[model samples]
Target: MARSDDAIAGSAERTRSVRLALASLSLSMLLPSLSTSIANVALPTLAQEFSASFQQVQWIVLAYLLAITTVIVSVGRLGDLIGRRRLLLAGLLLFTGASTLCGLAPTLWLLIGARAIQGLGAAIMMALTMAFVGETVPKEKTGSAMGLLGTMSAVGTALGPSLGGLFIAGPGWPAIFFVNLPVGLLTFVLAYRYLPADRKGAKTDRARFDNVGTLLLALTLAAYSLSMTLGRGSFGGLNVALLLAAVFGVGLFAFAEAKAASPLMQLAMFRNPALSAGFAMSTLVTTVVMATLVVGPFYLSGALALDAARVGLVMSVGPVVAALTGVPAGRMVDRFGAHGMTVAGLLAAAIGSAILPMVPAQLGIPGYVGPLALITAGYALFQAANNTSVMADIVPERRGLVSGMLNLSRNLGLITGASVMGAVFAFGSGASDITSAKPDAVVSGMQLTFAVAAALIVVALAIALVSRAVSRGVASTEPGAGA
Candidate 1:
């Protein structure tokens, strides 16, 4: 009887340990996404210090994004080949080191390089964390665990600007990088202590890294990002070179994926209509979402005459609602299925986006806040529904690859969103050409931008609606279902 009691106690201890590791891993996965947007407010400070142009400062953000975007799929494939834990730990360590470098960098070019390294670390963390969760959790509880991870990511994103504002206000910009120091240390220690090792039972076979494929993918993304950067400029020789590189790289990557035994991107998974459509919709949704992240804060502060802190507070509302609303949405998805929830989410988001342009310039806080809440709620529901559909469509073996691909698609969409919206605003406002513009013009441009974003979301809604027909009708028609 005593031996049996000891065994039970050991089992309980293991469970507790697993839970702790899961929580830490969740936080680790979340911080990078949070950090991406939170630091935007500090760009001006970095620019002034380095005597850099706005275009150069843009690279600070773009470099990190480009690095993550280009390398994530390959890193995910590598994680599967080796152990996820090792790659994750290595990623964390590199991230910590890169953060210190970013804080200490003296020049914009150096900072850009550091950010690129930082992106590499972020890619490792992003790729391995979900795979680790899939390996750790029980089959029945996988949905719940993923829901929690998504919630963490949402909350982190919501908190980023607010927290970043505080850091900037308190001790200037370096503090933002320093903030990650303690959190990274704690997570590293906790993960090491509690998480299981991955050397055993991992795929160990004859596998060779596809060097040609990796180069092609990297060149493709880099060229595409460069083209966007130079879009505001004249179409000269450099622009033509970048455009050609993008085209050639894309062709090469496609050819490689088709021929390689283990392609970095598992294009085969798109065979599942539900997963494919879900990912496609997610990409479009983020195109809108990414625009909002960049444009919303700018409008609230630049046009609405709010302070940085207030902008952070206001911008945070949508993601906060999303983090909170995710659980119930997940349950609803499980109970009903994907079709209804996704369509409803898209429609709701579209409505919310439409409301943004109608916000009265004369109206007070409550007027704007209400529409913000609607947008946030809609976005939350959309994310929950989309995540459920994509993850559920695939089995456990491919969760890492799927998560990586989903993120890559979302990141690319975000880049596209920011670029396209910026272009529209630049052209429509007539403010982009001017070195310094009046507040009124800026506001007018923002209003136009918001209207266009709304239209884009409505287009997303139409696409999602078509998805319902394609995916065997809406799933929310049953009683108490989501749609």
Candidate 2:
């Protein structure tokens, strides 16, 4: 008789030795999400204080996204090769120091630089934490544990705007980053005390990082982000540089990935249709969800005549629902597999997005609830199922690399969504404040953004369906198909 995975995980989690290790994993997971959100509310304040253009103010956010996007895959592969614990600790310390710098920044440029450093730390922590969970927990428990981790990030994201607003109202912009200090310190202390050392059987693979490949990838993303940031701004040279960087970057990285003995990422992972679709779907879903998160607040406050606090309250609905729905989605993944759940979620989200622009001003608060709730539910289900399917499809040894790539897709999606939505809002309202616009124009812009978001979700659904077809093809050809 075989021993059950749950029994093994239970034994492990019960051990005095593993308790602290679990705590470390929890903190590593919590801090990045917290840091990401902690500054959102402060953006407006930062813009005022630094006398920045709106595009410059956006760099304060985009810098973090770009930095994290560039490094996650490399760091994840490293964690898989070396050890997740050591890398996680290093990331924690770096992140804490960077947080201090962010709080003290005297100029927008300095702050953006500090935020980029913070993102590097975040990537390290995020990649290793997922790898750590995958390596430490039993197979039966992995989905649940990942779901919990996702919820932690979601909570942090939800809290960020409101908490930042509180700090800005009370002590000004510095307080937003300052709040992270105590939380980070506590997390570090717990991590050092509780996390376990890597098991002896794990291989310490000796592949050196492909620095040239890394640089190309970095340049490519930098250019992409630059183009997004400079939208309709006076920066033609920057745009040209970005275009060249992307073409050269992809071409060089592809050549290197194929030749390297221990590639930073195995591009072959995409050969699995389930994994491929999951990655693509991850990108699209994140782009739509994050774009909504970015734009919804403006829609509430700028266009609808609500204040900052009211916008925060209204915007909170989606993440709140997301947090509630995640665990249930995880259970469904275990029972039904990733494809059906993901497709259903995407469909619902598309419906929700389509409804958002149509929400009449005359309908009042109750009318707002329906579309928002549907969007939230769809987001929760899609995120949970997509993550599970991607992890399940990958080999255990390479989980870190694969997980990092998936996360990169999501973060890059965030960058695209923020940029695109910002451009859309800028074009439509022309009123710097969203709520002050004519009802028709506001509705038009909101409708256009929502419609684009819906289209992206539809794309995700199509990918999920295609992946299902591929999986069925593989299964049908197996030895037992005729039996």
User: Every model's Cα RMSD, please?
Assistant: 4.7, 3.9
Candidate 1 per-residue C-alpha lDDT over 1-483 given as tens digits, one digit per residue, 9 for 90 to 100? 999999999999989987998887787778787768666767887888888888889888888888998888778767776666777788888888898898888778988899899899888888777677656766455555656776778887777777777888789888877777778777788778777787676664546566677778877988877775564534578877987989988888888889998676656766666777767777787878776776676567666778876876777777887788776666665566656777777777778777777777677456667776777677667776677667664554566677777777778788777777776666656775523556566667666876887787787777676765665544545556663
- Candidate 2 per-residue C-alpha lDDT over 345-415 given as tens digits, one digit per residue, 9 for 90 to 100: 89889999888878886775556668988987888878877887778746656777877888888877877
lDDT of 2 at 163: 79
Evaluated at residue 467, the lDDT of candidate 1 is 65
Candidate 2 positional error at 84, Å: 1.3
Q: Residue-pair clashes per candidate, as listed?
A: 0, 8
Q: TM-score of every model?
A: 0.85, 0.87
| Sequence-dependent TM-score of model 1 | 0.85
Look at candidate 2 and tell me the lDDT of residue 464.
89
Error of 1 at 149 (Å): 2.4
**Model 1: residue 96 alpha-carbon error in angstroms:** 1.3
